[model samples]
Target chain A: MLTGHRTWIYNNQPVIISTGTVGGPFEANGNIPDAFDILHDDMWLKQSSFEKAQRTMMEEAAQIAIKNSLIQKEQVKFFISGDLINQITPSNFAAKTLDIPYFGLFSACATSMESLALSAFIINGDGADYILSGTASHNAATEKQFRYPTEYGGQKPPTAQWTVTGAGCALVAKNGEGPRVTSATIGKVVDMGITDAFNMGAAMAPAAVDTIETHLRERNVDPTYYDLIITGDLGHIGREVSMDLLQKKNIDIPEEMYRDCGLTIYREGQPVLSGASGTASSAVGTYGHFLKLIKEQQVNRILVVATGSLHSPLSVQQNDSIPCIAHAVSIESGSDNQ
Target chain B: MIFFWAFVVGGTICVIGQILFDVFKLNPGVTLTIFVIAGAILDGLGLYDPLIDFAGAGASVPITNFGNQLVHGAMQEAEQHGIIGVVTGIFEVTSAGISAAIIFGVIGAIIFKPKG
Candidate 1:
């Protein structure tokens, strides 16, 4: 049911039955190496191109999600996925491989939650019995498309974020026992006229803050309602900026309680300047790490606000400011069905 | 002594590019353009030739050299063929480098796929 203008309260509470997270060597050496279901030492994953590697990762993630669940591949009614590649070709090729009814989405990094929220809404509305929602990104592929070539020796600033080389997928079913999707808040495109493509965290922070504030207000819940309110791919700068913005708005989410997926994925001194950013940053962080914590009862509720910077290389080169968006999804442990 | 100067000069130029990128927040494309323009202007002022004589390959190896070559070719042809030679001579000295880049790029594309 529609809770407010852009928020959706999943009355049926579709459950995320199983998830599959895959990472490259860089992420395998990250903070949550064990979180990923599959960790490939090779960035190419034996593929000729980085795009093909990305597709392979997505396919592997989806297959792992299905394999982990009780359902078969045929039981999955739809596949909703996306990536940061041009035309989102990695996801398109993966969809072809999965051979499921596909709904290719593009909200940049926010695609993870966008797909999840939509999957939950579909299952809640009896649109499908099983839906696979996921996203992927390849470091070299994203760099080649958005910034420079992979081998380009240009120095990136401290504010620059590393594009995650990974994919994460979740199998959501109408009836299952896992983390339940309670609510979702879709964000608006918020631009503060930031043109520097390197500082995406700053460009995307306002949108994340806007979505989180709106989600809290529209859902009639306090910031403390969820044990943790996580933002997607808002590295160090963005995380700090959004936190300050939240405080200014009198939304008091404690520092420990408010975390960013970008910061949580990699270890310190990993050379990921600000932190990790990509469609998979939030996907893998949430599905791989936080969900395990939720299942282990280390954490109860989480509000994943996946942030996205929606700017093309052409748009950036044309001197267009980045327009960013964030999508928030509330996940609670399935033990408490109430 | 020549090799030492070349190393120092080339390293200094690279350091300037790095500062432009890291401190001034200029992108690689912009930084390279600035270097090229600076090279052309220095060549126009007849300042780059002495530096090239002193530093040899160091002064002539960077992207700045491309700009110097462009202006140098244009000026030489302008003396002989007047105004129209300016446009015609721009690519004269740098054609080998550009052509090699294209040829090698195509060959690389054919021979090898991008590594991760």
Candidate 2:
């Protein structure tokens, strides 16, 4: 590794939304809708079960990983997974058919990296053989839990991200010089009790900033040491608020060096009522794109920060405050693969 | 030169919209709102129909259409009800969005008996 760390190996694969559900229209590429509608239906059908929707994505992620790695299911050791569900049925379902030990986690959308972090730790600890850490989040499920159902069609603020309809899973290895999960900076839930539910991106921004700062501090690593710093889907508003707030703290990370997964993954205006944020937004993008970048050695030392807004609709409905959390995981790309 | 000027001016305006997106951190919907508000304000003073003539969907698709509908509704309601008439009231002078929300909200409460 360029930074004297265990290098992580990555194989980036593009996620074609062929076999998955799209909440709304996924404006194709930067400027084109798909040349033709490939969905079973001409229009996006809203599913009733969050688990059903989440599974559609998790399975897609697993299939992609299988194809990319060309590894069999039996080859994987422990499958560590989590999701924003009743008992994380999506991850459990993903694991049920797999040939591995499954450990499911729940920390809202932060579950992805929380799973990845622990996976890295276990791999480094040498207690586990080979593992796959994954998480799936559903847009409809998150909204029903945190805000309203799609049928509700409530007036959405521009800052809100439409929960992305996708899942992201990563295969972690203890051997064969794959991309190794380096240092994981765990984050505590930050509760500011900001009451404007419509502008949650702003509310969650402070927590993300705090976590990033804490992660760097705890690891005693500088921002310059990493080639790119990525954040989970915070959408347009959260991204702005996060960058402005971070710069004020004297963290001079430029806009280019940092990519907001929420903004990067979705079409600029595909009519995301809340904006772009669902478990799938980060999942597909990180698994599909960022992993590709890592494989290409486009950026070596990368810090992946996934943010979660831990507010359920019940809490909001009952006039309780929103608690947000962000987890940071460092994955160093292995030069040997390149 | 004149056609070139037209293309330059038209393209520059769209480019400015993109700049507002990239650098100024404006959401498409919010920026759309601003454009519509500006158009509506101008149209209120009888000045923007020509812009509509020049730029069809660009001017019409925004919130300016909302304003136009509200203005039309108010004028029609005002005319029909006369000075003594309170057609749909001032708050609901535009569309049934407010009226339906209040009336249907009460109906839903009665029917559903929602839990606290």
For each candidate, what's the DockQ?
0.47, 0.03
In model 2 chain A, the worst 10-residue window by lDDT is A13-22
Instruction: Name the runs in model 1 displaced over 4 angstroms.
Output: B1-12, B22-24, B54-58, B78-88, B99-115
Can you write out model 2's per-residue Cα lDDT over A1-338, one digit (the tens) per residue?
Answer: 12223222222211111111123235244221221121222112334455575666566566555555645767766887788777777778878766478898887767777777777676666666556777666656666666556655554556666666556677766555445466767777888877666667777788889888876765667888888888887777888888998989988787888887777755655676545676655555565567667766787777888888787766865767889888877766666333
Interface residue Cα RMSD of candidate 1 after superposition? 2.0
Please write out the lDDT profile of model 1 over residues A144-216, one tens digit for every residue: 9898886665668889999999999999999988999999999899999999999999999999999999999
What CA RMSD would you report for each candidate? 2.2, 11.5
- TM-score per model for chain B alone? 0.97, 0.44
Task: Give the Å error, residue A120, model 1.
Answer: 0.6
Q: Tell me each candidate's TM-score.
A: 0.93, 0.65
Local error of candidate 1 at residue B63 (angstroms) = 2.1
Evaluate residue B87 in candidate 1 and report its C-alpha lDDT on the 0 to 100 scale.
91
For candidate 2, give the lDDT of residue A225.
82
List clashing residue pairs in candidate 1: none
